[model samples]
Target: MGLNYQLVLWNNHKKTYDKLIVLGMLLYIILFAVVTLVFNSETSIETLVIRAFGSLAIIMLHIILVIGPLARLNSAFLPILYNRRHLGVSMFIAAFIHGGFSMFQFHALGDVNPIYSIFISNMDYGSLTDFPFQVLGFLALLILFVMASTSHDFFLGNLSAKTWKRLHMMVYAAYALIIAHVFLGAFQQETSPFTIGILVFGFILVSSLHLITAFKEGHIDTAKTEEKEGWLKVCDISEIEEDRAKIFTVEKERIAIFKYDGKLSAIHNVCKHQGGPLGEGKIIDGCITCPWHGYQYLPANGQSPPPFTEKVATYELKLDGKTVYINPKAFEEGTEVNPCKI
Candidate 1:
């Protein structure tokens, strides 16, 4: 939930950076396209590759855009949220390549103006047989360009989160447009009844899975952030052993109470990545290691040490007589509760 867009020294060109990821991805696309175009004994393989890659690219973009909203409903899906923008920008590049190829190869032949030809060539809005399919891709690409241009955190910071969220809602519209593009453009051309049916079935399957997850997660109020509760007695200070933690659920929130080296600290039981239970994780040196992915958080504050940035919210704790009680009231995320009266 914390999006600190502050300028920090990050090695963006590292092999892990999204640009390299997409660049390598596009390179593979180019390699495959070249191999298919060159070796296709039949002449139509090049065009088929273009349309197929184009559809694949747009569908991926839909997945990238929907992940954040999807994660709100499913804890298992948060890793996609943690790493989504890379996928967005990658899809943008794919769409751009697909659009450019379609324009140059199909529309720019002879003396046709590509832009004008793209619009006037297709007007099949009335009937399935006469549908204007190319327009759908053009419109979807436009949507993608707009969204990709503003995908950076700078825009998220400048435009308020709410406004940015609303603006980005164009993704759903783009998804529908691309689906229509696939049906009208490729399915209409290939009409190999079986392939077209398979494509539609695949599309429906992926979309149905997302819809089912969204329906399930829709009941969760992701907007509800702060956990407010009166002090709840958990266990005797003696019952909490060294280097171990007890977890409790209060107000639909899971919290971890830790006892390490005679000190008590409390943090959100869920890992920031995918809600891994922190209480079940072991301590490494001074950091509490997440049980699932080994993401480390300081026992003092939920902040990750140098070289990693993920954070979790921490709560106030006290040893009331021998009984430990938690002030379930949440503090500003990333701040530590030094519960020990040193």
Candidate 2:
């Protein structure tokens, strides 16, 4: 596995904020160079500045769309998913640049109306092959704009997760349009076989990543299937070895019971990341660590500290005389239910 450089660095929230500001400063410099110097000097030339930005925007869109699924397939990609909305907003801003520049360069000027020029004599529409190529970019930008506008957690908190996911799924529709835009707008105009090969090759690479993810998660439904609640418990305080955890199978469910020092901590063995067995993972620095991607959980409370807020169903453990008893009820975060007595 590849080492995560960012994780190894000193983690300070304020420093992260400062880094973002630095990145924004650098981005402004590049955008200024392109919009003012590069395009302004060649406004009258045929270098296709607007179309080039459109291609750039579409490529960024592919990265934004793929990050979430990629993170599921490989937890190492989690950082991208953590800051995904920022990427979406960046992609929308790039698309806005492409769209605005195209509008002015090809649609405005002269004594004729801007509206008439936009729809009719945009020069791109003159060719039979590229007549509707620009429209694909326009429609895709609109979709991206919508998604970017609603990407905040405020929208996610107000709308149900199902509704939010449905709205965001439009990103895929935008992706398809962007592919069409690239094929017709850039490849057609450039007339270079190398460009076509590059575009097609990029598409295959993104699709292959997604296909690999699907294959890895093909048994996800089976993992979630309910287990028959016949035999599960395999312990008591005296039964479990000190500083170790035991796994028990219940209604298709796997649970972990840990005895640390004098306190007993019971938790779901399934890792929240991808159902990796938590019982098999090692305890590090007072936290139970998932062997897969090092996700940690405090078994006594069933709540993760920083960087791992994800949770799984937890059981309530009780000491009846010496035999430990467990309750099956599990609830959402912030619920009033108390975990097993530590």
Candidate 3:
């Protein structure tokens, strides 16, 4: 939201979120270590630290992945989406600890370099059960490091929002590598039913949530809209919920038709910040608030409030009986259009 970037634009909510995250992480690590010691007193402290941090990192990554789809499925999860970057950065820190200690314990002091030993020490690539799974973890950690390093607004501004988003999308690839690392590494060594069940359950839950959300959005994207003259029929006025939007694809671009306060306005669906799905957001204080970051815009003009110059293209909307219609052509950014009464 600025030309020059500071470290962080912290608010009371962000501070409270961060403190809760730190406290929860500390409590989880302590409790995990204590439980491990109680059951297996002979286990080394190094192993305990490695296992504790590794499990914590995996759990955090799962939470981070689920947050997006969960938020899409229900607006109640949007608060978690607001601070997701913090969760990702915290997950990376835990992973870094796990990777560092693992390399030290398993590969250090060898004649070859520890980093080199990670790849060469176990070259059983042809065998799934005996693969050098540490290499998978190393690569995943590298991706996580890059993503975490660039999670700030400074990088987003310098890299351009599209490029930044594509780079961060590598998180899915990193998640896959991490799954392979755990399956071919830990699960192979520890063939306990409890461990396998937990891994299977996590994989199924994360995959199912993403699939469900994708299917729901896919239906919306493929919806057919009838065009008459120059106006496109988006939906019935009754179909749009109050304070929410009905999104439609028109002329290769997405349009968000929001019904609010007994009136309707149309704007481009993409948010100026982060290209978030603005149509999925609900109107608050008479402005369309972007779901990802809470960027707001007046629906009539597709412009932010004064002192904030961000704007999106607006569309001319009309009503015929119970049907809602929008002109397929878009107005220039920030152009004002009268809201059609509901």
Query: Highest lDDT: which candidate?
Result: 3
RMSD of each: 7.3, 8.8, 2.2
CA error at residue 230 for candidate 1, angstroms: 17
lDDT of 2 by residue, 312-333 (tens): 5566666656665555554453
- Give the per-residue lDDT of model 1 (tens digit) for 1-342: 224656534454333556655665667667766666788746575476576568558556646755654555455765556546667777888788888888888889756689989887766578886688888889888988988888776776577545776677788788788878877767766678876666567567667767877675444323233322567776678777677787766678778888887788889887764455687676779788875446788988888887677778898887667877778788777896776641
Sort every candidate by lDDT, greatest first.
Answer: 3, 1, 2
Please give the ranking of all candidate structures by TM-score, highest first, separated by commas: 3, 2, 1
Lowest-sum lDDT 10-residue window in model 3: 1-10
Model 3: per-residue Cα lDDT over 189-238, one tens digit each: 88899878887888898999999999998888889878899788888898
lDDT of each: 0.71, 0.64, 0.91
How close to the true structure is residue 268 of candidate 3, measured as C-alpha lDDT? 94
Kindly give the stretch of ten consecutive residues in candidate 2 with the minimal lDDT sum.
1-10
Q: Which predicted model would earn the best TM-score? A: 3
Clash list (residue pairs), candidate 3: none
Q: After superposition, how far is residue 195 of candidate 2 from its true place, in Å?
A: 1.9
Task: Please identify model 2 stretches exceeding 4 Å from their true place.
Answer: 1-48, 109-131, 223-342
